[model samples]
Target: MRKELYVYHEGKPVQAVIRTYTERDFDGLIEVQRVSFPPPFPEELWWSKEQLTEHVVRFPEGALCAEVNGVLIGSMTGLIVSDEAVEEAHSWSAITDDGYIRNHDSTGHTLYVVDICVVPEFRKTGIGKWLMQTMYETVVQLKLNRLLGGGRMPGYHLHAGEATPEEYLERVLRGEWNDPVISFLLRCGRVPVGISEQYLEDEQSLNYAVLMEWRNPFNSSSL
Candidate 1:
């Protein structure tokens, strides 16, 4: 599915396209992750050739990229998981098979988002939201139960010493605080379902992630 939208580019708006990822997009995708998650974010955790290859080959529809003027600026990756798997709290690595998506099950009922990122310069221009909406569309098209993901609490470390993760999340839900990740998830139509510890290795989030979900309105089973 090719989706077109306008995004800020060099201080002006430019047309951008969102479409399924391809083999040639690997390098561009890596660059986007590099700038999006800079140093201290574990450079080794960035997208790898083998893992990206697996994404398109295994579940092409789940791997999407956004391009502006021939340059990839953002992307979202996903894998299908069963209801039983979604009910269990799982780490990003475990759920996505260490990013290779080796466990992707076409018959699974849920679309599990593994990662979503946009280049720092291109953010706040609706690119991230568009990528998310595209994934939501995928859930509808596949007639899946829902879209599920573990959202990083990048802003939680600041409140970690004063409040528990749950407490901090409460404040965020009540609009007392705006977590960079949680707030964005809420804006994208996802609701917090629970918390997952050791969800990722990111030091910024202190290995904590909020479990978020967006149920498909068109799916009767989800209703």
Candidate 2:
């Protein structure tokens, strides 16, 4: 694993530590998720710190974190998935078993990118991008078959009053409009498959999400 990462602040590069999650990182990752995800859902929908720990406990290799000067700032979590459910339409709660990571399957080849988050203070920095790239690298390195990267369309909230999820995704893909989250995800090689309603109760996206598939060509060629 790579140990050093650099992110920018006000156009200046700063050093950051990138590593896998340790038991001590539990509280920090939960805190990051809380601040990163803006909401429209009830308080009951939130994942408590203990719940987050369970994910790391079940699949430590699937979870990663970034820290700068010893302060935790970003994280990405995922779980292995297989069976017909991987191709069929599924909501975030369904895949995560309502946020418990109970669906994690080590025998599976598909890595379900459940969450990628960076604290607000670190926004606009390249840390989010790096975290994503790291996950992409992971998919390739692990020789996984594909990545089900569920990306939030936070910018969708701003335009939800004007268009449907399909319309918005079409516009974004066609270069007619831009969505901060989904748009970038596509650029990172995540291709939209469809939309999942109630996937997340994210106020920014109105409980809607764009499902994307990224296949690892290298893994297939060697098979």
TM-score each candidate.
0.96, 0.88
For candidate 1, list the clashing residue pairs, or say none: none
Q: What lDDT does model 2 reach?
A: 0.80
Best by TM-score: 1
lDDT top scorer: 1
Model 2 C-alpha RMSD to native: 2.5
Worst 10 residues of 2 by lDDT: 38-47
lDDT of 1 by residue, 97-163 (tens): 9999999999999999998999888888889999999999999999998999999999998999998
Given candidate 1, what's the lDDT at residue 146? Answer: 96
lDDT of candidates 1 onward, in order? 0.92, 0.80
Clashes of each: 0, 0
lDDT tens string, model 2, 94-195? 897766788788788888887777888998787887887777778888888888867788888778779999999998989988898887787677888888
